[model samples]
Target: MAATACRRGRLTLPAFLIALALAPVVGGRADTSFDTGPELGQRLLRDVVRIEARDLAEHGFGLVVGVDRDDVYIATARHVVARRAPAGLVEPERASHAIAVSFCALPGAPRQLAAMLDGFDGADDDLALLRAPRPSAYVPELKALAPAGKDGVGDQVWQLGRESDCVVVPTPGVIAGRPDTRHTVRVDLHGALGGASGGPLVSGYGIVGLVKRSDNEVIRAHAIAALAARVRALAGPPFLLGEAGNIPPGDPQAAVADLTETLNGYLFAARDLNTLLRQEIVPRPTFAQMVQRYNGSVNRFKAARDKYDGTLQRNWPAGTLPQWQALRERLWRIHLRFFGLNGQSTTTITGTERAPPPVREQMAALEPELAGLQSDIARFAEHLGKRSIDHAELSQ
Candidate 1:
């Protein structure tokens, strides 16, 4: 249905200078299920950015999704700045200067930052990313819904944008239908949506979608979870936009430091698992105890590993990415070996209750390997520290 709307010219792609309006809902009936609080609306306003491409003579709305190192990432609709290519996908419109993004939250003067078009996730998702230099001022931390699926029918949502008079207005809506297409969801708004394409669709405290298009009462938004993955793949590093705060401001070293913290957790968990597998305990624990301990250790290790894996590694020093990736691979191999030692399949470590014969010898064999990996990691950290010092010196 959406595909046909675009092709037949029914779906109006809002451009600059369009007089948009939102008629009041019939009977002024409100959905009593959920109420978007004023406090949340104020917080969301901080990240609502108005984008203007002077060269293309077009303007649209965008959300400040992330700030990574020196870059601030903004998410907007692809059609806002691009036309359909021959292949049906979209490409960035060549411009003389960067697209101007105005942060409405800044007090006094409205500061506009120049943002470069990063990339797009084809026409299906209809999402694009704009990357700009991080401002000295504070950036709002936007949380994204984890499972950004398009299945939230009847769930209340609020779309924040600065389309009318450049003021952030919160439009309440409820997810109406399941989009047959992937990476999209339909929302029936209480009021007609204006030219706010590329704004955020907030549900609760987290952003669930990016407003893509609207037809009177109903609008389509690109789900944030899917948009996150697409942006991660396109932009590389700064993988999780919402988790940018996890890394410090001074990047490269900041990323390295953050990674080291996760690795430390992994080391502690691995040590516990190793000690348990070797049966090196004050009181020789029973098989059940061993199983419980093993499961617990595995969970901790996996958590740490995932944290390390999901980090923004593109700016990690310079040559440290390969080393870190190698270390991650080695850790993964060790995880697989763990299941092997327990006589369990790597795929099915879930609800593992039974224990195999004593894996003392196998566990013993992995000690040297673990020790070697630890030594390598230590060297890696040391290298990272040296590189940080060198970088700081170079900058000076």
Candidate 2:
């Protein structure tokens, strides 16, 4: 990335340029599975800024990924501006002046900003973190770090960069594979250069990784999900690690689909089981028939819980993970109680027959829990429905 108190012109980094050090993707057909242009693109452009020099000597790019009360954190490749960085600089080298920034939001205008080295996984990884000024007047759409392991092979994604001449270019890539030697991703892409260092590789869900380097055959990125846990513990609060609205539903519609399927199953099973006792049957079924119905309902409930647990774990906010665990344990308790009711040896009861106090009380308590669970689930389903990637963005 570039340095400060200088004129706004081209940002030149080491010969490593982006290619010089950690510039920033490669191949595959464009994936329309998630949208990233115009709106989200504009927001990112404002953040994926051009790093300039005080004397107008160097240039490269950095992304504005996070912010706190005072500063905004810029994520770029260490090689791009690492030499000019004075904080962790090796001796004998002159301390470089502060860096200048050319933000896409304020085109043609560059501002002087101190680019301080915050934290970097040197020797082990190619990532670098820089702290910049974030005054009240400045605001860009902040993107959050996606949870690690959420991305899988075949997941479609997009890349953004400021390679040259101040244009923020978008490239499409797919998660092809991961290298065995290092914690780098092998993406099918090309065409990255000096100016493109430190760009972001975004999935439909949100910011998944940052560019490590690009080559003639493959584009590589240092996946951030795993590093996120470490980054959160860094010194500054400016690294607002996991903010909402930053990582929206990568595919909202798909998220809602599973929830609705299992939710409807739950609604039907609960209604049938509860109504079994309420209605007066012309010919009440035997105890075995009632037990079968109860068992079937219980099985359906357990399956639904598993399905729902899968969805919430993936899409729910990190803060809500514990809440989901609680819900899951509660669901298990409900299942166990119902299973016990089915196993009652002493009382053989038909649909219209009332059960013993203990069995009835436990089952009756489930009424309120089930009702509350359904309402909450409905709300969650609706939220997921509305939270999908914009239709236009995901379109081919």
Best by TM-score: 2
Q: What is the lDDT of residue 106 in candidate 1?
A: 66
Please provide TM-scores, in order, for all candidate models, with all chains considered together.
Answer: 0.46, 0.49
Task: In angstroms, give how far residue 13 of model 1 lies from its true place.
Answer: 58
Can you write out model 1's per-residue Cα lDDT over 1-396, one digit (the tens) per residue?
011122112222221001111222133211111113233445567877777766666677887766777877788887776555556656744432547777767655455666555455455567677777777785664433423342356656676764643443555788786554586878897465567788877654356678888867888888777777776676452644462122122324334555565565566556666665565232223333434444444454444343433333544445566787778778656655554442232112222422223555667888888887788778877776664333322110
Candidate 2's TM-score reads 0.49
Could you tell me the C-alpha RMSD of candidate 2 in Å?
21.1
Residue 168 displacement (Å), model 1: 5.4
* Candidate-wise lDDT, in order: 0.57, 0.53
